[model samples]
Target: MASLRRVFATSILASVLSQVLTATAQPAFGVCYGMLGDNLPTPAAAIQLYKNHNIGTMQLYDPNPEALQALGNSGISVILGTKNEDLPNLASSVEAAKSWIDAHVLPYQGVNIKYIAVGDEVIPGESAQCVLPAMQNLQSAISGSSFSSVAMTTAVSGTVLGASYPPSSGAFTGDAKRALSGILQFLSNTHAPLLINVYPYFAYAADPSNIRLDYALFTAPGPVVRDGDLSYWNLLDAMVDAYYAAMERENFPNVGVVISESGWPSAGNGNFTTPQLALTYNRNFMKKIVAGTGTPKRPDSHLDGNIFAMFNEDLKSAGEEQNFGLFYPDGTPVYPIFS
Candidate 1:
């Protein structure tokens, strides 16, 4: 254990030292700014934190007024989301979608809204029926205007996959297959990427006996899984490739993918959640992204993604959900992810 800690310390030190030479470089990835904690820093302060770290992109779970205000003219690329509960209303009436855009988006002219996610992880559930229509209405609302450049899409969890093993065999399940067909078509038509939340930590925790820790943490020294000519050294790439394969099987072969959320918990279950593991996973993940190392399936593609959250949300459900933050609510980093 001491040797392992020393290895982690050495690897982190090397990464931090390397970052000093590239302090001004724009980060290739983004972090989700979730506001579910009472002790969280103000939106302005949070925006400053992102600037201080040279972060160039962010994902907001919803259009919080203060956050959007803070983002105005800040020059940070944003992926703004709509509340799942609002989907029914937005889907039912194009006027409701137009009103939503008029209220939450148009006023913030300085904000760089890259993508507007209609709903989050509501697929394969009660609100699943509302997703495609809401996206259509929102797209119509934003058409032929400055906001037209802002892509329309929705975020879905990895559970939408029926099979993921071998990466190439990935396919959507029965329910998700039926529901996502039209949505996928819409995404392809609009040239928007499908946003997915991929968590190797959860995959490993659920079946540590089968999933290796090194594989999940991006520390595996050699290829652990070989799929035809492709080799997967880490779980992230494999998971991403699986999603791509699934999309291809769904007949949306050209639709791109953007990782909506991914992170490890700093504290929760005994061994599976720890500061060391969280730091390792996030730092390595960022490095992989910064290097523009696309997954084997999309070797030349420039992948876009966001870390799960900026700060720990104390108000979240107890355990892993609350612990997926890169920083504490007090504005201090839970681990030195930014160096």
Candidate 2:
């Protein structure tokens, strides 16, 4: 036992020194914490969940100081966002934006709030047009605040891209390009990753047979697809590399990519393993990303993902899939996912 312990310790140390060795061995995620359900656990309880589980990150749908207060003093980083409806408001009223920051974020200094996600999943609707100006205004708002190293980014729904198969032929829709160029330029300049709300479940639901279940679930797959010199074994990389390719088409290939929201619903009765599949997808995907990786094409880059939600919100639009919880409303994990 002592010899085994020594070997494991040495392996961890060597991995930190050699990037390639660590690329496949890193454990855990940086957390994707969301609270939108009526069956919801309180924010305070949720913060305790992070502490008990040794989590290090939280992705929020909006700037809720109650949640920040819940996480007070925890080193876990936060990524807060502006709602889609607030885009026009943010674009039109810089004062309102400032007021929001002062009220929502200013009171919570000496806390672990990390990133400000401005206008989440705003790239697909009529609000897409407002995204650019909203981003500019939010940047100004963040700059005006005392929060340092706190990044400002936007979330784009996967629908922004027109083609995503083969991973390399990815490109944004013609209309989406003109509408989003300004925001893209801003992100490129500011050095923020393109935060995307990716749902491979949608891809599988669109066609399950063509998409292998194991690949989506991150289980050991049949074989890697050798599309010429490029290779892929899972749906997550295919979905992400498409973004890389699309961004490359737009001449901003180096901009970072982050999975701002990605998870399986714990119990979607009518759909594919809504919650179970969600757990599987997140478990395998998070393990891989935290290990420091990208698609075979972008292997040097480490992938960063935030799981979709924290609670199985019964109040979230009355949809079954809205219950995308790693934990039940009472703070018990729905599944014993950890080894």
Off by over 4 Å in 2: 1-28, 274-276, 317-320
Worst 10 residues of 1 by lDDT: 12-21
Error of 2 at 213 (Å): 0.8
Q: Give TM per candidate.
A: 0.95, 0.87
Q: Using TM-score, give the best candidate's number.
A: 1
What overall lDDT goes with each candidate model?
0.88, 0.72
- lDDT measured at residue 11 in model 1 versus the true structure, 0 to 100: 68
Residue range 1-339, candidate 1, lDDT tens digits: 445445555665447635742864677788999999989999999999988877778999899999999999887999999999999999998899999999999999999999998889987889999999999999888887678899999999987999999899998888888789999999999889999999999999999999999999998999999999999999999999998999999778899899889899988888899888898898877777777778999989888778888999999999888999888887777766655
Q: Best candidate per lDDT, number?
A: 1
Model 2: per-residue Cα lDDT over 14-52, one tens digit each: 244334324433233556666666566678888888777
